[model samples]
Target: MERTGGETLLSLTIMSEYSETSSTETFSTFTGLGATSGKLIKRVGTVVVNGVDAILIRRRLNQLEATLGVWSYSTTDSEYVKSLYNDLLELSRPVYKPPIRLRALRLIMGRIEMMRFEDLATAVANWPISYSYGLLKTMILCFRDTLPLIDMSVGIERTEALVAYHYTGSHRAQKPEHCAAFLSWLGLTTSLSTPVFSRVLLQLDILSFVTEIYPTDDHLLRPSAIRFPRQRLLNALLIGLEPVNDAVLINQVHRIRTIFVWARFLNPPI
Candidate 1:
């Protein structure tokens, strides 16, 4: 069937959109049947592909947003959540512009914030260590956009669990890269003036805090080789500790001092 160029182009465009939508549906099926059945199916085809040809990407994002909106916190499925996390991570990669990538990240954090506390912990615990770390890095990169999406009103237990799961490796052995990323995330989150941020800091176990700071090896300990901001970390801790009582504040300060003193002695220049 010979056709004009415009007609051919239009046909190809329609086919591309259909293919991309089909791919998304196929991906969803492997994650779980009926996980995205009702409202999700309705929202799947609404995003119009523009000149950017980001139809698939935008469709995936829309699907995730819709899923999260309809997601059941009480009967949450860990594998289903993990699949969503994986998709959000893929969308947050460099292939997308900062806006799109950050939006994906924001959604990732939003999903974390939206989960029931127990489900949040279990889901994070079951996730691959690398996947958890990737999620941490996404939050770090989109600090401002993602931080407030976390519902601090969920109370200290959930907030601490969220931090511990991603940052401290509550379910797995901690990696240097994970620790580095955690500090970056903590540094940013603690910079806020709210007392809730302070309370979140206090909820952390001193052991996890020390482990992150203790410098696992020479690469991490070297003065010139430190990967995270030492002074800023100290400042964040101080800012966070400000709202605590004198006795508790004193204890935290002393604990922080022990690590920093050792760090400074090892790296005398700082």
Candidate 2:
């Protein structure tokens, strides 16, 4: 069906690839506020989103960004800054491509430029943190053919980061060991398997930090392209690091299973 407003129509064709649901519960609550969700509803221009119908969705996206920015701005009157931030990420499932997607990110940045969460600087502050995610995202984009998210970032640290980690090997040219090269290039890896308690969405905290990161949910891991020893590439996070308790190890195993499921979903032939 088509969900339209004025001249544009939103394609409801978003399937499992584009799970039209927020990955976070709090994010959904914020987006559900209707018009209070901000300016993610307007189309800045002809944003060529691949999966969903590009008409109404673009406008909705713009409104979403505006709403998030306004809500999260420290001085903004809205009392839901944290609530809205979570919502924006939750609504990020149908995240757009560069120039287009950049619009929303800029809005988020504008709102939170002066803010820091949990006393830790923003993820956008450091490139290693962001690049690791970006590199992961790039590989995901390759798998999904989703969208180009190569915008390095802005600031001195980002500049230093780009210089140090701008590019290294033949990760893109399909050379031998590209997968190994890429993962090794990433240095320390973070888990993206599932959400943890208390911390909500910590990216890389191992001690008492609950995050749902790992290869399972991340569509761009390129599991097929990565051909290392099963225990090394597949269970790198667990095996590479110093051995932990059996309970934590068991949790990691469960998350790995999630990755296998998604990989199979992406490439059924495997």
Candidate 3:
């Protein structure tokens, strides 16, 4: 029988609490005692049905599990891993509805949550709309908390807080901007264009953004266009603003001129 999302999570939770130290456990302990320590990991199979896609998902999950095994887990780390697993399980739900959405929100809002950024990114790509809907809804909930609920106001402050609270970074160098890139990718997937998304997109490397969001089209955003601030042109790309359009070409020309003008003023007659 195909395992339900809830079943998958329950099984993982039980496995994590396994007390009997078997041969595999001994091997894990030995591996941890080595020069390089390890993180707790559970073997998870693909939920997708397509054979080729399932193979890809399995391979990716293995890669993530391998990488996760390199990190040492404390009580807090273990909790974070559990939260991530649960979050993904919720995101993996095949039939997204109000009940699932509420469950996802309750988990997110009930506590400060954490997850592997890469895993979250992978889920954003691989999960079904129902899952994505829940994930995005949870994000929106977090975003709500950051703003003053007095007038029902939400802004970048709320956005930053949400990003910080959820995405604690998979590595040292992971920053708000990288989190933004992940969101930008998610936004592209879910058609969620907002001020927060734009802010995040602006902070991402142009090539990285294009490659992840518009992989097949390397030439979507021109070098000249990218030299301008990301916000100035991000909407154009997201909105499918045709480069061949006379108005867009004219705007690009004007933007390039403005950049040159600013450069000249900043370093006049060096």
Candidate 4:
């Protein structure tokens, strides 16, 4: 979806004429011939109305009227003024509604909170691909503070969850940095013991997947080649392995390093 920072509500140049016929006035009330007296307060200024500006301007005008007892009226030739009432009605109508994805995630998270470990795994496996990353991220963050308190049996479920989470990154619309950040958070928070770590790496086949997706020399050579950031993913992988002190895990880390070296050799420096 296309996103914008802000919207313009209205824009116009306003002209005002004030009557200065009050007896309290100390100065000349009329410059031109009139029954009482009048003063022209013509302001040639463009006012771009946005959020809260309309309300602020109205308040300022009201304050001026109350304090100085000066009665004034303004006119704008802009066609927008013709439908100002309708425009205000439109603005008054509610426009904020949560995205479908967010609502779905909230429901899923609620379901997950009451589920057994096996059921959680099943849910993760069956989760719609579009929102899998969101669900996984939410799960990780929810349990982050109480990782140590979690039962060991939940490790298997977490491993399955991670595997499912990894595949979510393959979605075309998925942001690489988001996936990378998720992995980094997982590594930093949860202590991925040998069995769980090994299962996640092997089940996901992360090494092979990374090799397949990493932009190769030929791809880089093409002028039209679309390169997305992979450095963050690589770093995330290394960080995820930081808690593993096993000799086998160390060898796996070295292999990952070798792949990095090969990738650097194939692709030219930016």
**lDDT values, one for every candidate:** 0.46, 0.35, 0.36, 0.34
State the lDDT of candidate 1 residue by residue for 1-270, as single tens digits.
123222222436445545554556554542323223322322322233243235445655676666754445333676766566555555544434555565565554544433322333334444444444544444433222233536655333234334434432322433443344345445554564344444444454433454554453434435432445444555666765655464575466567656666765675652
What's the TM for model 4?
Answer: 0.28
What local lDDT does model 3 show for residue 241?
Answer: 31
The candidate with the higher lDDT, 1 or 2, is: 1
- Least well predicted 10-residue stretch by lDDT in candidate 2: 193-202
Compared with the true structure, model 1 gives a TM-score of 0.35
Tens digits of lDDT, candidate 2, 182-255:
33222222222211210111222321111122243333444543433222333534443334434565466457
- Worst ten in a row by lDDT for model 4: 36-45
* Count of clashes, each model: 0, 28, 1, 0
Better of 3 and 4 by TM-score: 3
**TM agreement with the true structure for every prediction:** 0.35, 0.28, 0.29, 0.28
Scored by lDDT, model 2 comes in at: 0.35
Q: How accurate is candidate 1 locally (lDDT)?
A: 0.46
| Candidate 2 Cα RMSD after full superposition onto the native fold (Å) | 16.8
| lDDT of model 3, residue 16 | 37
lDDT of 3: 0.36
Please write out the lDDT profile of model 3 over residues 1-270, one tens digit for every residue: 245454332333333333322213454322322111122222223232233223323333343244343333333454445434443344234333333323333333222223223434443444444444434543443433223534335343234335434544422432333334334444343233333332233333332433343222212323323233333344433443333544543354345435545654664442
Greater lDDT among 1 and 4 belongs to: 1
Q: Which ten residues in a row are the worst by lDDT in model 3? A: 32-41
Candidate 4 residue lDDT tens string, 10-41: 22211111123233234532212221111111
